[model samples]
Target: MGGGSFIEEVRMLGQGSTSSSWKWWAVIGGLVALPMCLCAFCMVSGLGVALLGTVGLMAGEVRPAREVAEQFLSALRDERWEDAYARCAPSFQGQLGGPEELARRHGGDRRPVEWSFSRWSVEVKNGVRQAHLEGTLTTASGEKYAFSIELRTRAVGSGEAWEIHAFTMD
Candidate 1:
């Protein structure tokens, strides 16, 4: 009876079908394409989300100790006093005075003639992640000096993180 009922409906639909068949054709096309369209949508959205995740990981929102140390030096090399100072540890920030102090000392005539990372070391200290790096600094008057930075991880909601703790570069 079920098969017979379906056949009867199809036959009736065929009998009254319009000459142009545009309306029935649209309904039939939609019925055929709905599932395909939904599947494609899911695949595209999934790929888009995967791409975004990869980009986020590369950006290092949850950075490790060594990378943070490198970033700190890069900020100093660019004479971005506020950016470099802001990377300091919460406890260290108090001792470093403030951003204005950083700029006052490092900016203008006192800025390094040039600076670059010389070497790096990473280890766990009493369960805290740490990175030590030496940066080569040169002054405009042809004076060469060795500077160093130490960075350590601190709690952040995204998970493992690092910020500058202390340095001999000042």
Candidate 2:
């Protein structure tokens, strides 16, 4: 064969080898990259879902025990006996029967009273909540009584909505 023809043939073979190598490289790269991309996408989507769930829970379900307790105390302070009694946990209401019964049991006269919290703490266990409130209760007669009350609460439905379940004075 002529020298020029031989060189042309060699050049064509080199080109073909280069093209084949490039194709193989592209295939390997795609194989390695696909799963990595999928994993990254999954991780991002999982994080977004978790954040959304947390926000929904904070907005909907988890009622702070402190707020409920404060409202209950406010009702008592205003001498709204029935209102205050309504705020009590169902178990407590059942035990006391009614507002008049509760007042007699606690030695309260169904009159306005002042109360101050000395210490307070709240805890949640297995989705149930409990609050320990220690404070002084002052009657209209100027008598002050130190008491620690335990309040129990639980989430009622979807979201963080909560309702009092019980109350006990110790």
Candidate 1 segments exceeding 4 Å error: 1-64, 140-142
- lDDT scores for all predictions? 0.72, 0.65
Ten-residue segment with the worst summed lDDT in candidate 1?
57-66
Over 32-148, each residue of candidate 2 has an lDDT whose tens digit, in order, gives 999999999999999999999987775443236556766776766665668768877777778779887756655455333777677766667776666676777766667777766
Q: In candidate 1, how many Å is residue 72 off? A: 2.1
> What are the per-residue Cα lDDT tens digits for candidate 1 across 1-170?
25577546555565755554565566678888998999999999999999999767644432466567667666766788788898999787888788877767656655666777767667777998777778777754556778888888887897867788887754
TM-score of each: 0.54, 0.51
Model 1, global lDDT: 0.72
